[model samples]
Target: MLKVQEIRELIKLIDQSTIDEFTYEHEGEKIKMKKQILTAQAQTTLVQAPVETSPPALQKNTAQVEIQPGAQQHTEVAAPQVEEQRGENLAEVKSPMVGTFYHASSPDAEPFVKVGSKISADSTVCIVEAMKLFNEIEAEVSGEIMEILVKDGQLVEYGQPLFLVKE
Candidate 1:
């Protein structure tokens, strides 16, 4: 079994390097770590094989590690793509997590922010539901909502632009 500090070090290394995934197997232990660009996080799965088993079979055990946005140096590469898709004057409100996008707090309520709506840095423009958790996404920039890039109930990945604003 790998120690917590060792696992942390591995995650740090993976976060700094360009490798998106890493796996290791030795004796009865196996470890797998995969980096997800959208959320700037990494998930690790560890499997231990029973000594008595004729053929080693993996046991279900998993752990997840989240690297902060600052640790994701590769995200800078995607900035140019977004700039190319959107004009220089437009600011994008991106999804911070991979989940279903909802325009309003509930289906019966009016949408949080619509086209032509003015928003400030703290404005809650939409909700992103991931693993049954509803997270209110803020605009993070003051601007007028110029476009809604995604539809309600649509699945959106991390870093996907949900709305375009003219700042």
Candidate 2:
């Protein structure tokens, strides 16, 4: 376990650094933290509620999504098991492989996507550099990007949620 002061200092360091997210594993405790600016559009999604009246109504409403490259967005759908819970409609874009996630192709390149960016189905949203090779990731769903869960050049594990999109 980390002391409050230690956690505060870590957050301060992360705030001052150029990176957007930070993670460190010590002993059996794994801590992963991300710093997202929470753009205006993303803020709106938080307060919005899903229009869920029936089971079939939920799936029918989330049929179409559009994603674009360098500004890809993700959509949120209520989990099947959690349908009984009210007001949870968010989609997540997951990292396909295990490696370091890069927002851009290189250090000097612009980030592939950011909060409020639009993405399409074939758009290359980000890249995961592993074993000296860079693998481009695409947006499987199309929607307005609500949040960025990881920082550029951060080490991400497989199946991690990289972005959250509003559906």
Top candidate (lDDT): 1
- The C-alpha stretches of model 1 lying farther than 4 A from their native spots are 1-85
lDDT of 1 by residue, 12-96 (tens): 4554567767776666555566654444322223233111111112312222232222222111112112221358778888877
Off by over 4 Å in 2: 1-88
TM-score of each: 0.55, 0.48
Per-residue error at 111 for model 2, in Å?
1.0
Candidate 2: clashing residue pairs, number: 11
On TM-score, the leading prediction is 1
lDDT of 1 at 107: 88
